[model samples]
Target: MSIAWDDALKVGNIEIDADHKELIGLVGDFETMVKSPKSVTPRSIQITLERLQLYAHDHFAREEYIQAIAKYPGLAENKRQHDALRKTLADYIAKFEAGQFGDLGKAADEMAAFLNHWLMSHIVDVDMKMRGALSDEGWR
Candidate 1:
């Protein structure tokens, strides 16, 4: 699938929104990588996956920091969600590395679906709740 970033994913905060955009781009890059496993080397695939995972971790931290600064009441819940996301990513990576998906192409499709769905839903259902955050000051 041709996954592209959309403005509808914005969560009101500029920093958070920017991270979401980058995350979407990373997901797209990964989707492309997995779609054509022949054109990519194993090392290149590893690098792309590493970037995706590391960037996600960094984004979660940055988002939580912004929420903390704004004194968001849902900060605790947000952190819990972040923890779940991290765990889910780790589990999927482990499965992929262990050859649990049978083939790279199948794994690719599953990963893309999970990343796209999880990111979109989290941003919409959870992060969007902070659109009118209490304290309402600049978080940057």
Candidate 2:
């Protein structure tokens, strides 16, 4: 599937929205790497997984920082979700490294779906709420 960024994925906040855009791009890159015929190797997949993990960890930190600064009421719940995603990614990587490529396709597909749902649900539902609270508090 083509994972292109669109306005539909935006959370209506410039900083977080931009981060989300870049995140989707990285995800798309991973998808491309996974689908490449000649270039698809275990090493390449490992690199993609590493990049995704790094970017995602950084993004989650920034997002949580924003939530903390804004005193967002759902910070705990949102962090639980973040922790879950991180754990899942780590588990997937561990499996892949254990010579378990059989489920790589399915894992990648699930990752993409999870990301899409994050963009749709978390962005609109949680991020938007946090953004509104921050804006109302006169945060730039």
Candidate 3:
């Protein structure tokens, strides 16, 4: 399945929206790379996972910074979710390193689906709250 970024994913913050777009693109690239298992090595997958982790870290920091600046009430919850996602990514990396998933394509498909769902849900349900706060404060 191909995932595309659309208006539904926008959180009403330009910076966060751009970051999410980049993240979605990265995840799509990773998904494509893994779909052709024979064409990519395990090391390649590891690198992609690392890249995703790094990008996610940066994105979370940016989002948190905005939330802090805006005094967003849901900042704590956002941080909690971000931390959970980081842990989940780490677990996936560990599993990959351990050769726990023999079928890389299958694993990638699952990972892509999870990431897509998590991202969309977070943007819509969680991040949108920040947008609302910003709107209330005339920041949006």
What digit string (tens of lDDT, one per residue) describes model 3 on residues 43-130?
Answer: 7878878898899899999888888887788889999988887888788788889999777677777777777776666666677777
* Model 3 / residue 118 / CA error / Å: 3.4
Better TM-score candidate (2, 3): 3
Evaluated against the true structure, the overall lDDT of model 1 is 0.77
Instruction: Report the C-alpha lDDT of model 1 over 25-130, residue by residue, as the tens digit.
Output: 8888878877687845546656776787899899999889988887788999999998998888888777766666665666567777888877776677778888
Better of 1 and 3 by TM-score: 1
Top of the candidates by lDDT: 3
Candidate 3 clashing pairs, residues 3+ apart or interchain: none
Model 1 lDDT at residue 59: 91
- Quickly count the clashes in candidate 1: 0
lDDT of model 1 at position 68 = 85
Model 2 worst lDDT window (10 residues): 131-140
